[model samples]
Target: MTLSPLTSPLLEGVTHGFFTRAGGASTGIYEGLNCGTGSSDQREVVAMNRARVADIMGVEALAGVHQVHSATAIVVEDVAARPRADALVTDRPGVALTILTADCQPVLFADRAAGVIGAAHAGWKGALDGVLEATLDAMEGLGADRGRVRAVIGPSISQRAYEVGQEFLDRFLDAESDNGRFFANGVDGKYQFDLTGFGLARLRAAGVAEAEWTGHCTYTDAERFYSYRRATHRGEADYGRLIAAIRL
Candidate 1:
């Protein structure tokens, strides 16, 4: 099956995509294009799905990480065993950096002139801990100029669907009181946090030449997205993961 992936003009020159859960070998909760090796969907099926992604990206393999929601970013010289990090940056030709996400942000970065690209899995915890900035730092280390980088955030849980308690608000406020701008009051004392907006702000703050969000809300689009929050709310056994990738 042909896969349908979203792209941003900001990354026009880079070979990258924010792939939706569309065409693949999984069923049930992991209905389409479930590329997550960590998921319980049959291991062979996961491998085949990833291989399909690699083929689409025109790369022999896609490089990725274990993604533990930390701020760690690693530079890849070659595709080997997956590292224990949340982001990856590389200038190597023919290697595609990929990241998996459900409701979290999948951010892709590129510096065309430098032949450097990066992919990050930025959940709220990782974003708060500076994973986005760490990704930029790693890209710069690989010879990508921060001022020439373009970063695009893929589908994520939008503000209207991201309800959080006072504690969540407090965490953001504690980080920076200005973070309050990214939240809107929900019912009672709950607040809605804008994951994509927060990610864009961080990317721009880090001196990226251009940054954009694809404006897709994973939680609200069940047919095209695999949303962790949606599955948990519906009491499903497991959820699929969406992949975003970039090649230098």
Candidate 2:
């Protein structure tokens, strides 16, 4: 089956895709195009699925690392046998940089004039750990002017459906008092936190020229997206992760 990739014309003339689970050789709970190496899905199927993505992006190989949800960034001049980081920035053409996520944010960045681009896996942990800023820093390190960098966040859990406990709110407040604005009170003392908004704020704080979210909610949209929280609520054994890639 042909892969389904969501794109943004705003980042036009560049090679990038936010892939969905509509095509591939997977079955069971991990239906289609489950590219996550961390998943319990068959490794051979995962590899095949990934190879398809590489072919579509016109790259020999896609460079995706072991995402530990850290703020760390690695600069890739060429595709490596094994990459060991969360975020990747490169000026290397034809080397597709990929990031994996289920409900977390998958952010793609490009500074076209400098021919530099980046892909990051920014979950709550990574965002608070400064992954967004770290991505911008890595891109600038590769001669990309931060002011020329354009970032777009792919599908993630949205605020309306992301209810959290007071403990979660306490953690953010502990990090920064101003973080309170990202949360709105829910039932009782529960709060609804905006993951995409928080990610956007991080990008803006890092001096990104323009930043935007695709505004799709992974948890709420069952047909088009995968969601860890939703899967857990449904009592599923495991959930498939989606992939987003960008190349220069």
Candidate 3:
């Protein structure tokens, strides 16, 4: 099967992709394009899948981090052992920065004129902890201007599917009461959190020139995407991971 990677006009001229789970070697619960080495999927199969993604991106290797879901963003100068971080920024020409997500945001960042690019795995913890802003700050250190940076968040769980409790709502509200706007009432004491909306607001607040979500809900779309939540709801053992990448 051929790889089908989604692109954004805001990142024109940058070679980047929000890859779907369309074409890969894994089988069973980890059905298409499972690129996460951390997954319980066969390691060699996961490697082959990542290689396929690198081929489609036209890079020798796709760089990734251990993804601890923190705010740390590291600058990638070469492909050594993957680091323990949630995001990566690179000014190097052929290295592709990649991030894996099942339902969390896989955000790609680029400033074409400055030749800087980044990829971040932003779950709510990472986002609220400032992973998005940290990515831009790291890119700026590599000569990218925040005012010229363009960011696009790839497939993630949407507000309607992201039901949370009052404790979850309190976490964001404690940071800033204005965050209350990002939540809507859910059944019982639960609330629906707008993760994509929160991501965009953070990007805009950080002074990114352009930012937008792909508007695809991973939890709701089982065909083209993988959803950890959906997998758990179905009582599955494990779930596949989707990759998003960007290269200068």
Best by lDDT: 3
Query: What is the per-residue lDDT of model 2 for residues 129-212, given as tens digits with 9 covering 90 to 100?
Result: 898899889888889998988999999999998999999999999999999999998998899999999999989988888999
TM-score winner, 1 or 2: 1
Poorly placed runs, candidate 3 (over 4 Å)? none
Q: What is the C-alpha lDDT of each candidate?
A: 0.92, 0.89, 0.93
**How high is each candidate's TM-score?**
0.98, 0.96, 0.98
Model 2 TM-score relative to the real fold: 0.96
The alpha-carbon deviation from the true structure for residue 107 of candidate 2, after best TM-score superposition, in angstroms, is: 0.3
- Residues 1-248, model 1: lDDT tens digits: 67999999989978889998888888889988999988899999999999999999998888999989999999986596688999999988888999999999999998999989999999999999999999999998988898999889999999999999999999999999999999998998889999899999998888999999999999999989999999999999899999999996
Ten contiguous residues with the weakest lDDT in model 3: 75-84
Error of 3 at 158 (Å): 0.5
For each candidate in turn, give its C-alpha RMSD to the true structure in angstroms: 0.9, 1.2, 0.8
lDDT of 3 by residue, 66-111 (tens): 9899999999856765889999999998998899999999999989
List candidate 2 segments past 4 Å from native: none
Off by over 4 Å in 1: none
